[model samples]
Target: MEQFYTDERNVQILIALLKEHGIKKVVASPGSTNVTFVGSIQQDSFFEIYSSVDERSAAYIACGLAAESGESVALSCTGATASRNYYPALTEAFYRKLPILAITSTQDESKIGHMIPQIIDRTVQPLDTVKCSVHLQTVKDAADAWDCNVKANKAILELTHGGNGPVHVNLTTTYSRNFMVKELKRERKIERVMTYGKFPDIPKGKIAVYIGSHVRMSKSLAESIDLFCETHNAIVAVDPTANYTGRYRVPYMLVAQQSIEDENRNPDLLIHIGEMSDMAGIVGQPKSVWRVNEDGKIVDRFQTLRYVFEMPEHLFFEHYSKSLLSRQNTYYNSCMEKCNYFWNNIPELPFSHIWVAFRLHNLLPMGSVLHLGILSPLRSWGYFPIPSHIEVYCNQGGFGIDGNMSSLLGASLVHPEKLYFGVVGDLSFFYDMNVLGNRHVGENVRILLINNALAAEFHLFKQTNLTKVNEIERFLSAGGHFGCKSLDVVKHLVEDWGYEYLTASTKEDFEKVYERFITPDLTEKPMIFEVFTDVNDENEALRRMYFIESSTRYKVKNAVKNIIGEDRMEIIKKIIKR
Candidate 1:
């Protein structure tokens, strides 16, 4: 099918394989060793190639493309330190379960370990962060390079498929230039199979669906489910695990289980799609559970969990919506009335979780990709309901906060039109401040920094004799602490780097600053909104979010108790209350 240079056959074979597998984009930075690979791709018209001078930014841009398309994208760099520059993006791709194939062209084997220029161990450099790491032993022989290409392409597919991550492939310049290409075809027709199995031919009553994080359930699918559920008067329950809320007119799942004593409101058939639900306990026990998964395999994480594995959620929805039970409408009004009664009673106040969510959700522009930093802000955002158009992305694969700025920035680079909004805590933002270095950052990138001044997530953990100090002091003493006192780093980012900067010190400031921040007008340069709050205050505010006073009410209490102990909870309470 498609062809490249015959002399440098390995590069051509690899390119053909990649193109065969539906890879149509490549991001690259100019490097000598990877010249042949880059050259071959340059002349080829099948794939679009973007050139970024900085390898780090280029890798991140590639990541953005992969994240946007949910497909495998490639990044290339020459061997040694130049290739190693892709570390941040590789780590990000690994953690985010993104499919980004990084090809590093290394120096010849003879040039190894002799203090050669740009000749570091490319194979071992990104081992920890990449799903697969392969070093082509020899490329002079056609078989060796061909085998490398085949193996690398397979690894790329494996890393990307089944909702996994990225892979790394390293090759020497000799292999790139000297390898021979045999006759190979490059056409793959991928057919999506939709399957539906028979459910028990019984009347299904109140039905509920729960979706989890990192699962790629699109807005259309969610809306369809919402419509079907509403039409059938089915008791639908979508948790934060679904990563979608407020799409429906009525409240779906009771996050805190405030009040639902009615018998008809409970779920009869629970339809769970995507990942596992974060919330374990819920309103009413289910009669039977049916799991509609795209992956096909019935992976029972919970030993006692009951379900039937189905294929292609859309087909399942299409068939089920038109089923015999379509005419039924249960006590949906009564259930809604009950839910409304409780939700209306929920006090809307300043600094509350719902209040904050409402405020930010309203403040943020529609169609913004919310880049959530791990820990409190992420949990708060999860609990805080947002609008439908806002797409949420976080490094949940590894759950690491080391590269939030870099990851979002990378995504922003690729998608310049979308508002790349980030909600990150102080510590996490500071951890990856190096990402702010003069790199390619597109306009419309807004980072909302929810600064609590410390690692508030760990503030609830019990402090023994080993650690007995205030949260700030404890954080300062930690080896990996990255909290900045003077806001000098942020100032540098704003004033020196020419980033549109906005800072908020209080709730009033937050409201005022946010009002102007999310404008409908498109602007160049990324913006950062650094909203400051005390750790204890944030904790108390978030705790009161759920209206119900049960285990969740005492969760914050216990967390504080663990962090400051029982003796200090009273003091901390007094300070927060004041």
Candidate 2:
């Protein structure tokens, strides 16, 4: 006999997570909007469900069950006055701290204020009614699905968080009649842990710690992470902004996606720390991701989140370092071997941002501070290595292009004796160029503005890949702005502002001025090298660095994708996977 579930993505995710969390007892009230959720669970024998004609009675019954069993009990109700009836019992559960989950199904949220029949505004709930609330909309894309997963996990986790109380999950349904979908897709379950709480034992497999853009690294935190990586046979994938000086730190984000097929690339257990970097899906597809943040919120960036350790990152690493579970560095060695291979095999690229970083990264003065602007510069410099003593910063915590120059100026103020470098694109440099006039600006500032005359990031990579290259410049890249790379625009300003400006239009020009820009000594005036290049050359450099020309399989897959479209290609891939 075949089992079926609702085709609605959000509903399916809810059902899957409920099963994963083992909240099998359900009290369901009869209604149309909630039919998909109730019907799907009713068919699954794993759920022991009770029915009630009154929505108010259904919620009280769930509260009673949860109180008696000392476990979570789920309640479901449809739209209109039916969901309003659950407030009294939810209030009681909230005060008494009973573990109950109230799932109220509703029509599209857009219909709420239009005076449409059966649509009510459930967004504002009484503060005491539940401990937490998360409204789940229909899942549309990977990001939306990630939201649904995190919210569903959050709602479920609230049942046991702090004390225990009822939580609301306002689910918007599409009323889809399709129930032919077989087997629920596996969902990510998040287990939250705190200090003095039970911790998960180390699993035997390839493990890696991925740290994102951290502003500064304390000495103790660095040592704890180093010992953990060494003890657990693991590696640390990082960006320049990660600021982790451990021996195992691999700033391989530029080449991370290319290692999808390598087993070592997809760590079995990946621990993530700090805030996000601009590189989306840079860690490849991992088996599971465990996040350690003091805030303890579920941020399922990779969509594979399984644990959220609510403590300092160093504590999480130190806790696991005492595992005493014997391990070897085989995983670390294997990944580093492939990482080095990828670096050496990178094809010769055109004179572009990546080329500039490759030529200048290692040559930077030691113990200096380096700042990279948004996406392209980070991707370029992240591929190369700087000295361990050089600290790195990027505006990626906000992931904006507004304050690259200002931030560099601020950092250089305190460390006037040490050199500071700002590597930014033209748009970002001009956007925050006002910082150059500040009286506190120091002579240690070395700015390298890569002026392609537009937002070169928007013109390359997976961004609107099907859009024509020429058309991209018109709108997406916002080309023909920013003085159109006028040689004198920046030069005139720098000279008037009492700073040295060097302009370069070709590789030879950059080579000729390289020595002056990277010289270790502090100069009388701050210096800037505004290197100009063509957007076509930037795209070429990215294509070569990503190894697009060498991947015949990727070429064929993309060709098929362009012909059949992404949706159909996804279906074909799913069929092949099956």
**Per-residue lDDT over 250-311 for candidate 1, one digit per residue giving the tens place of the 0 to 100 score:** 33444434432345434666666666444434435665556667774433332223444447
Provide backbone clash counts, one per model: 8, 0
- Among these predictions, the greatest lDDT belongs to 2
Model 2, runs deviating above 4 Å: 1-12, 24-30, 38-69, 88-96, 138-147, 174-187, 257-261, 280-282, 323-328, 345-349, 461-471, 548-578
- What C-alpha lDDT do the candidate models reach, one value each? 0.63, 0.85
Give a tens-digit lDDT track for model 2, residues 1-578: 45479899999999999999999999999999998999899889999999999988888998889989988999999899898999999999999999989999999888978989998999988999998899999999988898998999999998888889999999989999888898999987889999979999878787888888886899899999888987888888886788888778876665565623555567788898979777545567788889999988888877788889999888898988885456567766776776676776777778899888888888888788999888888888877766678898888877898998898888888867989999999888888888888988888998998998888887776576634666777777777887899988999998999999887788899889888999988999999998998887998887777663335565687788889999998898899999
Worst 10 residues of 1 by lDDT: 187-196
Name the lDDT value of residue 155 in candidate 2.
93
In candidate 1 the C-alpha lDDT for residue 434 amounts to 68
